[model samples]
Target: MTKTVAHIEKVLEVANSTSAAALSRLAASWRRSAERHGLDPGEHRGPRRLEGTHLCERLGAFEKLMTVAAPRLDNLYSLVGQSGCAVLLTDDDGVVLDQRISAADTAVFEAWGLCVGADWSERHEGTNGIGTCLAEQRRVIIHRDEHFYARNTAMSCIDAPIYGAEGQIMAALDVSSARADQTEAFNRLIGAQVAQTARAIEEANFRAAFEKARIVVAESDDAEAATLLAVDDHDLIIGATREARRVFGFDPLGALAPRPANDVLGRADGPTGFEKAERAAVIRALTRAGGNVSEAARQLGIGRATLYRRMKRLGLDQT
Candidate 1:
């Protein structure tokens, strides 16, 4: 029996015997590919590609992501390109929007349906790197014969999902290698870099989304997770990254309700009352006037004597 046929029989044997929930991630993906997606492990057809006009439309929709991901893609490819790897960025639906590949390997990747506009979603391409990562919403590495389709068993794929500003899965960053000499240890190392690059792209897009707001990193046990919040001048939380939203108990997909930064961060808001408000207002005016009592009084719309009396009553004289 041929190797491809033997691989197909093995895949079918495991897929039919084990329930998806009872299997490992790889086996679960295999089960989904064979049963849910209705894909044959022996199928030899290439991946589906979007036509010119449709691909153009998808590219337009992903303009911001492509822009932010360009430098990241270049940097990742620079690290892995010499290893006969191709770096690709795909939209949320798994359509390749951008890629970086060396001239010598272009024909090889193109022949394997790793070109721009190719669909790599699990439903279409089965359990491969980009598709499975999107489906599982996490970083994944599919090496060689681990691939669901026999034709795709020659390539190794490492992928990470890129989350959007609103904490949605917006894109995927992938590094794929067709070299027969690729090893699992090397794949793990490259997988870490791919995940980090994906996080950088997510942060850049998040900062761009809230350009005018102050970006603050939320304290978390998982430092590797991107836990960020965007606060406006008024000290209201205007935006949050996916990890931050989960960390702070904010609505993941709904619009932020503009909660006080102190309240969300669990910090003390200090004294609250008319006296405190008056004290704060007077102090702000005094600071803004460079501690000139006369100018401070003028700014506060009060007589100098009246301001002095209020400041003293508010315990400002002690300071």
Candidate 2:
């Protein structure tokens, strides 16, 4: 209890101070946020819960994404809930859209206001796992007294942002424990696991959103860091994952897609006109055939020579 009070006092000192660099980047960030929101160290604000039509409307907006993510999130919950943690999925605006809590922990988590429809945005709840992760646009661990509000001092949480196909934050996944005194390494491990789970949820959502589009998954040696890009029939890049944008050098905040895939994928001189789609199909067939030209041609119902010519036209033969 004394340690908790001391941590709060330190955070308050940082928050009240105007001098920069008094705290490290993350600590200073939380302090500044508390100052901006006028949060009092002595006060423990209750979560703002949306109800009725407002709650329904907010949840309705995320129906498609929720459908894609709910099952995967449930799997994640099962993986971590044994530790007395509650898994929460919050929409882009920081409203809890879905949750998974064991019956044994439900009452305890409800006391911390982690139920669906609860608002955990930084502006509303001060610096918390979900809100701060979204605010920083990164994964984070807000453990116990590290939270900006005194009310949240008993909670230990790790959060990771879930990005949409358009490379923007679609939601946040958080696993928070009611247990106290968790080591930093333990918290970091939970953060890493949550990040991986969030990536899987994002990939699943991307596939569902572009079910008919040509989805290309680019994977690095790390394997777990694969990137997904969806290209339409017109050979336009319709969607890209956050990893795709970061790894492939595409603008995340660009227009609502339909960008030419060839230009984005470094294939400006590869194909043109009506042949672009055909070239893609041939390449896919060749890849499926393990680069056996004859087999690829046969699969496309075309002669070997015709396939060679098409590949030449698309600049694939030289490569």
lDDT of 2 by residue, 92-207 (tens): 98999999999998998888899999999988887899998888888888888778777788899899888887778879999999876667788888887898988888888889
| lDDT of every predicted structure (CA atoms) | 0.87, 0.79
* Backbone clashes (count) for model 2: 0
Worst 10 residues of 1 by lDDT: 266-275
Residue 259 lDDT (model 1): 89
Candidate 2 achieves a global lDDT of: 0.79
Q: Taking the tens digit of each residue's C-alpha lDDT, what string does model 1 give over 52-131? A: 89999999999988888899899999999999999999999999999999999999999999999999999998899999
Score every model by TM-score. Answer: 0.83, 0.80
Q: lDDT winner among the candidates? A: 1
Clashes of 1: 0
